[model samples]
Target: MKLILIRHGETEGNLNGIYQGIKDYPLSEEGKLQNLKLKSKLENINVDKVYYSTMERAKKTADAIFDFSSSAIYFEENLSFNEINFGLWDGKDYKYISKNYSEQFQSFIDDFKIFKFPEGESFKDFYNRVSEGIRKIIKVSKEEDNIAIVAHGGTIRVILCELLGFNYEGFYKFNISHGCYSLLTVCKDSAVLEFLNK
Candidate 1:
């Protein structure tokens, strides 16, 4: 089975370099352009099932690609792969969040293994959520269908690391772009990364 993992197109928060975790922002004009580019790139491939996060950015991007098509599109709350929730820092600027919540944010950056947002879920918790969703998707995959998932950067990284056995420290190395796709081909018990950050 072939799994195509796509990161949603750019958002205002992305261009602004803000921590977008789950703030629910829409795509910017540039993001729309990128999405169309991706659509053009994926044109002839037969995509059986399209799944994405419920967030507007993800949902909208999915709609763009899978729109006016016969494919079954599934939106799942579980697919909303988000970073550690910033709690009190959710909508604030990153610099402000760092300045105000310096110690907590530092710990979070330095040793994410132990640090978490003041009132947010831990990295372990976030990883478990993505893992559960991945297992479910894998179990449901058939021999012929091609699966596409439009998800967040955080989600994509977690899935790649878990499925490919990449070390935790190397998790951020995936470096995916907005609307870019990463391909993974899976068989019974093993999977190989076809292309990453494409």
Candidate 2:
């Protein structure tokens, strides 16, 4: 089985570098250009099912891929892979959030896995959610299944930590740009990373 993990195209929040937890921002015009490039790159690829975040940006990205790729893709909105719920911090600038909630934000910067958001989920909880989703996806993969996932950077980061044998603290260490994708070849025994940020 081959798993294609893609980060959604750019949004205004992304261009502005805000913490867009679940603000439901759609893609910007420039973002659609990025998706078009990705679609051109993935033309005629084989994909069995696509599980994407329910967020608008992710769905739009998925649509672009489905339109370009020749595969008959089955799409499912899995909240399990949604971006981290920033709760009170949603739709706010990171610098602003840092200025306001300096202490809590500092704690998050120190060790995010254990830090709980004032009105949001802890990184630990987010990790568990993604893990559960991956476990199920892996369990149901047939020998020739090819899957795709359109998700946020944070969602893909946690999934990489699980697939690449890394820890949660290193989640932010990886750089996954918008409209980029990572490929993995998986079997019942092992999973191999083919390429990342393509």
Candidate 3:
């Protein structure tokens, strides 16, 4: 099976360097253009299905691909692929979080893998959610099927970590840029990254 992992296009929160988490924000004008370009690039690829986060940005990005595909593709919104819930930090900039929640911020920086955002999910929780989603995708897909996943940076990183056998703490190693797609060749026992941040 082939997996195409895509990060949603930019939003005002992204441009402003804010943590969007589960907050829903529409794509910025620049983001729309970016998705258009991505759509054109993927028009020739034969995609079998598209699984996107429930977030508006992810939905819009998935729509870009589905709308231009030559054949009908199965599409579904999966909440498990949604961005990690940031709790009170949602829509807040790093500066604000550091200033307002200094101790918690420091703890997060010290060991983010175990740090649970106040009123939100821990990294472990997020990883499990994304991993389950990936498991379902793999189980339902045929060996030759090409599956596309449209989600947030964090969500995509978690998926990559799960597939590539990386520790959850190493999720940051992947740089999933907005509107970019990474390809992976996956099997029951092993997975190989074909390309990243493309």
2 or 3, greater by TM-score: 3
* Tens digits of lDDT, candidate 2, 1-198: 888999999998888878887787878888899899999888768788889998999999999878535456677899999999998888888889899999988998887879887888888998989988987998987879989999999999988888777868679878988998899888885778899999
Which residue window of length 10 is worst by lDDT in model 2? 66-75
Displacement of residue 43 (Cα, Å) in model 1 is 1.0
**Pairs of colliding residues, candidate 1:** none
What's each prediction's TM-score? 0.91, 0.94, 0.96
| TM-score for predicted model 1 compared with the true structure | 0.91
Off by over 4 Å in 1: 68-84
Q: Which wins on lDDT, candidate 1 or candidate 3?
A: 3
* lDDT winner between candidates 1 and 2: 2
Q: Candidate 3's residue-wise lDDT over 55-127, tens digit each?
A: 9889888887676454677878899999999999998999999999999999999999999998998988988
The superposed Cα distance between candidate 2 and the true structure at residue 59, in angstroms, equals 0.6
**By TM-score: ranked, best first:** 3, 2, 1
How does candidate 3 fare on TM-score? 0.96
Each candidate's lDDT (Cα)?
0.79, 0.86, 0.89
lDDT of 1 by residue, 66-175 (tens): 76456354445445454446567666788998899998888877888665666767777777788778878889879777888888898899888878877466577788
RMSD of 3: 1.4
Ten-residue segment with the worst summed lDDT in candidate 1?
71-80
